[model samples]
Target chain A: MLRSGPSVILFLAWRGLRQYGLSSIVAAFSIALAGGLFLSTWKIKTETEKAFRVYDGGFDAVLGVRGSKVDLVLNSIFHVSNGPDKPLTQEQYENLKNNRAVKEAIPLSGGDNYKGFRMVGTIRKLFEDHEWRPGRKYELAAGELFADDRQEAVFGAFVARKLKIRVGDVIQPYHGLDFTGEDSVHPNDFVVTGVLEPTGTPADHVVWIPIEGALNMPGHAEGLGFAPSSVLIKFQPKAKREYLQLLYYYRNHPELMMPDILMTIAPLFEKFKAFEFALTAIAALVALTAAGVILATLRSAMNEKRREIAILRSLGARRATVTASILAHAGLITLLGIIGAFAIFAGIGSFAADYIREEVGVIIELFEYDPIFLQVSAGMLAIGLLSGLLPAIQAYRSDVAQNLTPTS
Target chain B: MAFLEIANLRKSFPSPEGGELPVVEVKEFTMQAGDQLALRGTSGSGKTTFLHLIAGILKPDAGAIHIDGECISEFHEARRDLMRANSIGYVFQSFNLLQGYTCLENLLLPMAFAGEANQERAEELLEQVGLDHRMGHYPRQLSIGQQQRVAVARALVNEPKLVLADEPTGNLDPSSAAQALELLRKLCVDTKAALLLVSHDQALVDSFDQNLDWRDLNAAFEQATGTS
Candidate 1:
């Protein structure tokens, strides 16, 4: 018998599906809806996890007053805390800096804001020594870093865009970090010396200043040179033993125990693991349900196409040909769904990127074409194949003679 | 050897009374290449079953059927499918054109199964059937006569050695039916393909080279039903 190749089969399948336009469209979009949800959730989880891993401001550990370690990581690394955590004294900061395992220790003093943007008091080391991500140092978009003792401030990219702050603009700092408009405004205005390019980190919304500027705020005067909000520490890679010893010594030391304990970022990431697993599980369930939808739609379509299958069989198509045609029909629809899902994700990313970055501290790069997406495409294709399996078998087993005869 | 041959062919189906009912019992039949025969039978006389068995669409319970030097009855299902695809053209009573396909696509459908399609030849056949202008029209868009003409065109597209016209004009009106029958016979003769036309119309049977009364040939039909 004459044997038709895959191209012919595909062409015929395409023609057949196109004839049933509404059902084909409905089936395709149902898969797309599931695929889109999976893609969005997967993308958000990946980006957020990446952001969390690097959000620590290049510090290995945080030294703060005894409190929730998760809160300390949240406040010190991400700068997102409801209320102030107790501070580390100047002596504690000096001890941390003097530790042999601590390669660099920088003081972070907060409790001030400029229109809801956090006013973080840090030293020159923050701009010069920190890497937002590995090997990526802070690059100024405009102006220079702040001096050691001055009212000058450096704006993060988002803060500048939101408040229209630029180099040479002066903004009054509020005495407290709240944005209720009731917080007393500081007497001195802080001049903007620089604006940093977007680092895709929480620093993008912070106003950086010399530690002394935070100290000199009206209520903070008495606490000047005595206490700091937290001390961020970077450990020497070769001094692991010394680092562990120092951490153990500090946590157990009677004099330094109350308000100067160290909290590493490892525990915070552990907590995030559970939350991300739940999100991924939900997304997988959505994909599975989508597969079910594909199966049901194809199986139902098989009943309608029984006569068509018989015609093909009568024309010399083997059972395999009919089966392959059904599979091809399903594969094409699923592939279209995947393409549609990507387009939808791109639209969502374009529309919600800035908002996601601002709120979730994770940047959404639309259609980055991650290698993992190849795996996702395969998963979708597998679903397509599986969903079409029963129907293909049904087509294979169709009673050709019965279907070919005209109904009375 | 005859171009088309059948001997001791037998087929049966299970009856509602829980017994085997013999449907076809043909002792011998032969037709030369390019010969045309009109077969007439009652509704339940197994006329369609004979066509189906000859086409290798159904395996006869006991028989030897040969077409174009191939013993199709002995062939495996797949080989039979291939033989049918390569050697036989069937024109069904209802036209049986797939709904979504254009007339040209319908004509080319068999070629797709054969893994070879000749678009120029298909167009020529369409032109021969007076349907060149309607090649792009869907089956549903055509008149019943026009659809039958397309079916006729489809039947000859593969240039098979045997063409089965199963009541090819059954669905058409009188004028259209006459036109369809004439077109089917003319095209079968033009292509040098043997034709077996099944119909209930005696006047149509007179147009063919031979007239076959199916009930008289099927001994099993009378024995099973006792309807001499």
Candidate 2:
């Protein structure tokens, strides 16, 4: 015999909830769907930001044709840029490489694909002299880097597995940017010479080759010397001490004005803030719908609950006890919903990990114990209790004398 | 001071005709501790209304209800609620047992409000009601007679001073009703709690130690036509 009115209320409320098992499950499931959506969206945002930060390669700036700075960084670094601007001339690349403030400049050019994988044309220094990530240089899993200007290709880990091309195998390049093109440039059989180790970055899906071969390709834009799609510059450590001076000089210099040197990483993140805000609004709407479902379920079930509540009153329950019981019922439903939502999140994270990695190069880390999850759960509990307010008030005002008599 | 006392008690509800519809009017009534009384009346003749007024479930329009020397009608709603929980036990016509709880759980329900009830004593009361064998059975699994017996056990769980039963055996067959009535009366006596039962059955009324007709106790009815 659990004494105290509140204990009795809890016991009775639990019994009542169990009596309508199907309705209880439906209420909990609605909340679970909302919670799961909210959690996954947050997870995606966290992982995407982490990926962007990690892949910045410690570079200070990007220089490209006067256009979207985001597109310049995307094209030069990740091979996902959709810019229509013409490639920069070799004279511009040399001019940037010779700048006193510049420590290194890596040239990039690409408009072709090999069997659904983007073909990147760059110098051997991109592999040997540059760090693909801070303190981490590019290493081959098998064979060597492309040393000859002949049409030899180096496959990323995913591309090699996708195309099943070994070191001695030959493949043809498609002329267009999109990978699904049917027009293969004949007599341009590129041989696979190397396969790089997985770096968990966008490079896992590209095919690397010497820039000279890409420049000599028949359909490529004719230039005075080697042309590049963009330039990735690593500034001298001294530039940080004179950041304002360098910023003004880069933004105003005439020779560097045809193409712009953009402090792009910071601005790109500003755009992501808008995307994050939209996702948060979507999560809020889902939670609102879930709250509505819980409220409607309780209100609809109040009819059956009237008799039960009256019986409790007749047994000497105070109005507060009755109200507490109703709130307790709602709290229990939402608590179960939160538990189910976590399970659903884990299940979906596991199921979508490979696909997300393949499409966007972000690993969906499952079961990463985070305090934000606890905060989300607490917020949902509050929502559940708030949803119960109307029904609890109704229970408190129940007519014990009338509802006691058996209804005809 | 009486174990239960009422003076000039009156209660009414609003009629559809936009006037007060008098439900109960009793000039005086009293019951001593451990006494058994039967209130017999037709349906809608204010029998249950009087019971509600005495139990503090409804407020009297103009009167005082004193139980154990304290006038309960003067208490606030929450105080009345607490008094009812601690001192009064009700057994309804339909047995009103919560559906999912077992016989033992139903017996322990009042204790949850009134505070610590001896579990051993609850089991003993269930045995006294001839339900020792059905302690684990749910309400729906028991016969009407068995359920009423469980209700009787539950009413005595808090060891209240007064037990109000309204047509407790109304839905039982005659034999089951007799058995249920016997168990209810026995438990009330054993627990030393006064029992007040309302019923329309003359035969049932005849079994009690004292019986009063509703028309005899209703002052408003007597005055309306001057015929009591």
Candidate 3:
């Protein structure tokens, strides 16, 4: 018995596709276009969001040196591009840590990039703060984390993915601020201890070493004196008002160069939320338009297959059977197209990480495809299926008898 | 009771200008199992319409058709579909063979749709039509007679109790027409299914067991058997 098993149905659906080979290819292309755009934007957005959200690793506030809040915000939070413009000495960090309003403070030292990425020199408290997502904890694929403190280093996922460095691999570091001189590009060789699992964020593209490691380096990076970019301060939720007053008052202290400079713009989170809103809105509009194109293409294809459907009906195919066949065909085409598009993007993700960072400021790791890829792909598929529903229903509802009668 | 029976069958359509237009007004008709019957008519004579009505493809404005003791005309659209799948097969005049399918694919179509892939039965039926060697070829590659032979093979794939064909060989050459008729004759006996062929070809009509004219079929409802 030639029963239509899943494989048989797959074969039949595949065979049915050959009748309108060109149309089927077009359908796939449309689906790929829709799925690809959604995925590329979705992946980049998700990873970038994940990167920015990394700021929430528990430090609600940062009590920097007497001045240069922006520099403090840049370096201590993002671990890059923030100059230690003001030497926020160790006493201030200690003072904030011991304050009634302060919960915890993690210090960061951003020195140099072995390549285009920053080398974050921080403590274990970094991972402890955020309550890292699954598998975010460091695992030793070969050697241990930077236990020795002075020169030992830890690697991020991208170190291996991009630089092809392995545990025990020694790479030269460069001076952070004085990036001009050739000497700045190659500071000293440090052995790669452990490789961090991909966070799908900026961290994935960075290397980690003890703050002392950068502090011991040459002129700019290894701070000659007190090289604190900023002091991260976490305040208890209820401590905001009084602490804000204290922060304002402290800023006014003559020691802070200009203590009167207490600026209140928007909450960092508000800025992020608004940015999120705008990016997602653009993505949604583009996705909707892609969906419309999909609908038009599918509806037109169904019209072309009307006669074939009629023939199937006259051959005793039930309406549901006919409908299923059409749906299956549409779905298969959309699926193939989506996969192709995804493959293209996956290629981009792997091969163009540095280029993307250079071009768009998206510091995503090329090691792992973002996990959100599946969610985005599923959404694309749903959109495609919904797009096809109108034609499928039309094919379903039409009278079999009328369609079966061949017109002269 | 006849193997198939229709009573008080009336079909009407809304005229393009507005009111109702009466199409076919047959009050009664009956055929025994295994009967080869021809429904003859001119263009728009309602021969195809009557065939569709009996095959459960169309609902009469008012009437009933019983096939193998099942009153199909009264069945809902869904049941009619099931009835068509399980008990009836149609051989469209245009050879309505799916162009997407090969010759064997066409022959196997009914069995495939009927959810019974019975390869042995399909092969035997194909042999019955004497075209077993042409299974792999698509319908387009086959001659008109060969394609018609395939249509007949499909009609018997499910061993249906009733086979409805519209102009079964209208496009075929004389030889193909005679051959298709011969296949249809053997199909009725082998499957125990009554065959209803609708066509304008009088020669094909004379070849069947019973012949009925479209104008004569609408005689007084009570005069059906008498006219027969």
Candidate 4:
């Protein structure tokens, strides 16, 4: 008995591709594109999910005068979307701040823009509550956050990327409720006093200035009695449920002048979670479609390889061996395509992260492993394997004897 | 006892045009070790089908097939594959040498398929086929004759007891054909393998130890059926 080597038909399997001509190349490409579609969609959805999870850690109610739900949600926290220019007054900010049951309240003011990006005005101490630290907080890759409400500003990561901003460069902000367009004029010249380390969030796209400086800006005029888009509050440990009830009572009191159009942000966050799940499902479908596309290509190629398949059987190759050969070949191509797609996704992640933060104030770090990624990838792979099975079996079940005959 | 025996073999297919079309039928055929027999026929006269059935690539509708005197007709696929691998060596007219592999790789193919990779034996077969210098050349790089020689080497590499070749030299030039046939015959005699050569070339068939005309075999099949 002559001892054989690895029973692998990898060599013959490879020949099967070459024997068929240009068909295999088409299959490889189709499989690759399908895998890439699954990969990129998964990456984007995963990034969005990750960014939302980060947002989840902070904030509760969005207390504002009036606006659309999506717009209010965006500006209340994001500040880039549309909202009232005249947010809550100092008295209103202080009113929430003084409420003993409130525990802690962070006030946000809207005023200026650095180029086409916003300069958010907020209380300084709240940065600490946001867990913004010396090592982690607005560390100036170049300078420091403005210490006073003067002509000074902290540049967002994206703005810095675009403007090539550096310490001591004066930046003039446009006067508008929305910074969608640039209208830089009127001594809005703010020295680039700081550059924040990338937070991979919308904050990375902002220009932070003192609330006093924002109020002094000409754009800050003609707007009054408007509560800030939102006030984030943290309850004391073991705080009672009555505290929220009393706060709501005060919010509606006629004398309080609180707007009836208050949107509690907790529900908004729950809505976001639901939205994330829907999107994840959508991502899974897209990935499966990619796999389905690959299977269809393989099925098409089966007809073209009939002669070669017949030849394999004539050589005493069992039906299963031929089937195994097809499966092994296509399976390998899919796996390789998956790896290639992953590399492609990794390469584009940073740019994508920047895009999210700038277009919407959501920071998305590249290396963060969102579980949705694995879920989507697994689903896609399962589809791919399932797709390969039928073709492989067909290859196995084919009549090898008839195939070998030249006349057939 | 003969190396291969076929008794009342019948096989057919469900033709697209209609009911079962009888492809090949043979009654009481036997070949001993060291005998070279040639089967001559037209394209559709069941020549390839005969080789296929003997090689266990196809199952007969009804027949008895024996390799080394043991009935293999009723054996399952796994058992038939083992018998085919151990006893039967086959060469196709196309040389079917996997284009991607080198000559040595082609020669080693059967051994690899049968899980009987004997590197030394494979090298020796390459040397015997006069392809020692071209072992590293791919089948595509070799001429048709050289490729056939490599195929022959592959067929005989596993040292099977019976060698079956379907038009072993059909695609080769005259001189190469002579060389390939002489090699097949010599290898059969030397290794004690029952060599069954199928071809349309009457001249080549006449030179074999015995000749089985497909016309006579078909007549025999019909007579046996008519008698039964």
Candidate 5:
């Protein structure tokens, strides 16, 4: 027995939940699963969007051969795969470097791998001039940068840690993106010159060599004359007019394609909108079904406890008291389920953040506060209380005299 | 004025055949403070219905049930519930102790509804009923006689001015029934509470200071039996 009205209601509600323990647990678990799925999906969608929006890998655009802008950005900016097959000629590279609109242009050539890690060919200016983020220059953890016209390589942090390579060790480059067999290994053995510190960017997964070494490698097209895969360009600040003019100039050029990094990645998220909607719809359906289960379970428990409820009324409990007790029961279950949902979300969100960082090279902050957490919890709690309304009404309207009839 | 009073009390339930089946219709009844009365009636004789009416568990179609000058029948349902909780104690025949609560919790429940739940008073009542040792036991864990004792303790926990017992010993053996009746009568005398007991057992009714038969008390019962 309790003293206050609310305490009595809460006590009775807690006892009622304990009375039907298994059904209560099953209902709460269903709510947890639905909530976890919704939270995970929503977090992934929002965080992925944020990651792409803020991703500026030192350069503003990629000038490459006429083809898919998305592929060019993926290969040149994110190091996702081997560079494009059609390479930009030395004349095109020199023209872009000498353009007044372009502040700097670094050439990138990639068609080979050292044990599945992409090996990119670029000049020393890449390490000397580029800052991945504002005021954040790449620094070496060991040794020094590779010199031009040498069969030497500088490994990214991830590549060095993964392959266990040191400054003095040498590696044989494989001719293609994937390592098929020993026969695919090139005769060119590049010594490890340095290992870059972790940058938390896609560059952390690359191995860099000189442009001359990549262009002059054996079995390469020698007479085509210094054709790198693509040129990464940085535009001067406040050069929006010149940038748009260059974009328009390249739009009509049959042999060239210039893609702003942000513009190329923004449309990809638009394509994902449909998939996100489908996932949200499935989560909403599951939530509705969970609410239904709460209703059914409580209604059945109410029916079983009719006699007990009548006994309460006989002992001077008001109709409002009994009704509130039922609603409180629903509230308890919903609160427990919401707590469990948070735990489940943490597990799933952490796993997803790790997967995305490792596979896509985009960092997602797992613990960032979002308003969806509050909205989903409050919404589910309201639905749970609403689900208990019918049974509460039934309890309120029960016939005390009839139910309390002497069974003896 | 009497501690308990009833006049022109009428109650009816919907019959299976679509009309009204009269249950209780008493023209007049009265009891003094602390007076003990036994009401005897066979099955379906409106005995339990009369008890329900006085306890305010069921509303009468027409009546003035003045318990300690409150005229509870004229009050709203919520007020009647409060009136019952504060002034009238009820002991059911089957010992309707809540299965989920312990013996002490059962006693404390009524006091809680009355808004003055006192743990000490509940524990003292359990001691008076000789159930002090069983205070922590649920109804299922107690014997029938012990369960009845707990019910008696629960009814008196609020120290109401009146008690309504509907065959309180109906489930007990003869020896246990005698002992339970003795304890109930002694407790009522000690608390200065009027007792209105409804039972069909003549041997049980014979010991009361005053007794009334349902046919003599309830005009509706007599009319239903064609003996009015």
Candidate 6:
């Protein structure tokens, strides 16, 4: 019982849409596909940048052997690669730990893996002092952490769940980053002492063992000597001058390299700029094609419904009423497309977030409200209305008498 | 004053060759309230064009068309459209019901345009036209006679002062045509609305109390054909 006004126009438009069911569905689906891809690509790019840029792993800088600063940070901080080419000796680690400007220094060593999960050896001070974020220290989910002198290990949450290891379970380290040969397995068995709670960082995929366990292993004492892979350092809160001095000092040092962690990670995204741009271009092209589909479908519908429109006019519908009805039809299709787009975006965003967390160890906020969603929706709505314009004009100019006449 | 009046009403379309081709030119015509008048004419003789002018579907190039003392010809196209929606109902020869809408919805459509859509009134009219059982059926689902009945119900849904029916039964068989005409005229009387019917069937026109041939009524047709 809609009165003659916008509501009536909307009612008639909805009826017209339902009358052209398959074409309407195809148009809406195309729009949804475009919108979903646009949103997913944008979200992945922005969220990945945010995650990497704001990464805080409880230390200000990484000091390693003279090598690629990116490789040093990626290996030492993110635990995603083989360790740096050369290791800093225990004497250098002790020197940095005892420096007047250094508040704390944690040594990290990695050479072996268990079931494809990298095992890192670090000091007890790391567990006791480091806060991954301000006021958020890691807590053990099961038993006690490994002692600095013992041949024991702690498992990260993801590794523990994946390998199904428990406290007191014994694991043997493999000689390489991946499972290579039966003879590559170390003879010593490290008892699982604890499992750390989920930290949503690279640490979630690591196995933590004491530095003594890594240094004293069978073949390691003869070939590697007493050297740690890298030393992660934090300067005193009021020692900004000394921190910059040390960074400058390491720039030309013959055997050492120190880099600001944030500076080192920011450039990684630069490598992805071309890939991101390609995805964005493809999304935009699909969106434009979707707009064309809407235009073609609506125009075809108007052609098929010309006689019906004339009959409506003969029943006293004003030209504006019929025209508005066509616009309303387009609006409804766009609305459906936007809703479907959100569903598709959610599905894809969740998958991307999970993949990044598992493979790259970065947590992406998938459902945060980004203005791009609103902006894209508005743009699509405007395009939809524009697509309906020609058909609306055709309806406005329809000849009531001629179209309403009997064909016979 | 007459319920419907037209004075020197003229309308023309652009001719394919050149110049304007006069379609309808009625010197004067009037119908009183509650009256039934039939207009008879041959094919392409300006009968439908004259009806279109009266219904305000087409603007008169020069003249005045007044319905119930209001001059619609002088009004703008939008205002004329509003006047038509609120004061006049139309039925076409082919039972031009919206194929998407049910019989009941078709009856309610005119009322919606009139800004006074009443579901109860639409149902009552459908019942009156013997379409109560077919109210939920779409036009394509209904028979020819049923569709015509739905058209008749729609015409009176707004209780307009004038109902213009253009060959409302032309597509029906002889028996269905006579029945449709009787039902339409009966409903017009029941609603107290004036009826102006245009048809080529002389037998149908003979049933009306008053009837006029289009050749005599439209001076433009007589001039164009060079006929009396």
Count of clashes, each model: 5, 0, 2, 17, 0, 0
The DockQ-derived docking category for candidate 3 is acceptable
True contacts kept of each: 0.58, 0.65, 0.46, 0.33, 0.43, 0.59
Predictions' DockQ, in order: 0.53, 0.47, 0.40, 0.37, 0.49, 0.63
Between 5 and 6, whose TM-score is larger? 6
Q: What's the lDDT of the predicted structure labeled candidate 5?
A: 0.87
Native-to-model Cα distance after best TM-score fit, residue B112 in candidate 4, in Å: 2.0
List of clashing residue pairs for candidate 5: none
Write model 6 residue lDDT over A31-108, tens digit each, in one string.
898899989999989998999888858888899988788888888888876678877887888878887679989898
lDDT of 3 at B159: 79
Q: Rank the candidates by TM-score, best first.
A: 6, 5, 1, 2, 4, 3
lDDT of every model, 2 decimals: 0.79, 0.79, 0.68, 0.67, 0.87, 0.87
Candidate 3 TM-score restricted to chain A = 0.60
Q: On a 0 to 100 scale, what is the lDDT of residue B85 in model 2?
A: 77
lDDT of 3: 0.68
Candidates ranked by DockQ: 6, 1, 5, 2, 3, 4
TM-score attained by model 5: 0.92
Please write out the lDDT profile of model 2 over residues A177-268, one tens digit for every residue: 67665656645777888999887777878899888877777766665468887777887877665545555765776544322223454456
Cα lDDT, model 2, residue B77: 83
Q: Candidate 5, after superposition: displacement of residue B144 in Å?
A: 1.8
- Summarize candidate 1's per-residue lDDT along B38-131 as a digit string, tens digits: 8876666788888989999999999899887778999999888888888899999887888878898887778878767778888899999888
